[model samples]
Target: DVKVTQSSRYLVKRTGEKVFLECVQDMDHENMFWYRQDPGLGLRLIYFSYDVKMKEKGDIPEGYSVSREKKERFSLILESASTNQTSMYLCASSLQGHEAFFGQGTRLTVV
Candidate 1:
């Protein structure tokens, strides 16, 4: 079975704090992605890696960065948390042209 896991299901941070969110996939997928879901804006991509050490900025990457040092793991970094950055973060993985599997999202609240 395809499995994706997020490091946390809930997070709370103060403004200006740096936050790290981690994800792992056991399915050996070639693509991993990070996205944030907001009330009105829907899910917006943050970053994606198609291979280890290679990353592509997605629709929204202003306050975030990503790392994929190993094939089964991906990490998302929030440089400086802000109230506006509060949202649900999701991690996903998929083989090329295949259906993606998603992790249970992390709900972040920046105070």
Candidate 2:
């Protein structure tokens, strides 16, 4: 089964602290993505990596960044967590956009 697993199911943090979220996939997919979802806002891409050591800033990558030093793992970093950044973070992997699998999601509440 193609699966993506997130490091956390829930995270609570105060404003102005750095946060790290990890993700792993067993499919060896070349494309991995990080997205934040909110009610009625749909999924907004934060960052994506096409291959190891290569990354791209997605639509909503203002306060977020990513790392992909290993093919099966990707990490998302929030430089300064804020209440406005609270949302469900989802990790996804796909090969050429054909049927992407998502992690369970991490619900982050920045207070």
Candidate 3:
């Protein structure tokens, strides 16, 4: 079974702080994605990479960046975290055009 692991399950940070969220996938999937989930707004894609060292910006990329130097790892960076940025972050991995396997998710709170 494919498994996606997140570095942390919960995090709390002060406003204007820098934050880093890491994700790793055991499967040799070619596609990896980072998404932020909010109550009513649903899941909004932040970034994605289809190949090692190749990345694409998703729907919401402001104040966020991603690194995919390795095939099985993807990292999301918040340049300067803010209160509005507090949300659940999800990492997913999948083969091209196939169903994606998601991590348990990391909940971030900015005060």
Candidate 4:
């Protein structure tokens, strides 16, 4: 089975602090995505990488950036964590379709 691993299950941070969330996938999938899932706003894409060293901005990339230095690893960096940025961050991998294999998720809380 394909597996995605997140660095942490929960994280708490103060406003204006930098945050880093890491994700690694075992599958050799071509696409890796970072999304923030809120109560009603649904999953908002933050960033995605189709290949190593190549990245693309998603729907909501203002407060976030991403890194894809290897085929199996991806990272999401919050330049400055804010209260509004507190949400469930999810990492996903897929070949091309809308269907994706998702990680358990990382719950981030910014105070």
Q: Please provide, for model 4 over 51-102, each residue's C-alpha lDDT reduced to its tens digit, 9 standing for 90 to 100.
A: 8998999999998989999989999999999999999999998886757899
- lDDT (Cα, 0-100) at 56 in candidate 2: 93
What are the TM-scores, per candidate, against the unseen true structure? 0.98, 0.97, 0.97, 0.95
Error of 3 at 90 (Å): 0.5
Q: Residue 2's C-alpha lDDT in candidate 4?
A: 81
lDDT by residue (4-111, candidate 2, tens digit) is 999999999999999999999999899999999999999999999999999998999998888899999999999999889999999999997688899999999999
Q: Global lDDT of each model?
A: 0.96, 0.95, 0.96, 0.94
Better of 1 and 2 by TM-score: 1
What is the alpha-carbon lDDT of model 2 when measured against the actual structure?
0.95
**Candidate 1 per-residue C-alpha lDDT over 1-111 given as tens digits, one digit per residue, 9 for 90 to 100:** 779999999999999999999999999999999999998988899999999999999998999999999999999999999999999999999999999999999999999
Candidate 1: global Cα-lDDT?
0.96
Model 2: what TM-score? 0.97
Candidate 3's C-alpha runs over 4 A off are none
How many clashing pairs does model 2 include? 0
TM-score for candidate 3: 0.97
Models sorted by lDDT, best on top: 1, 3, 2, 4
Candidate 3 clash pair list? none
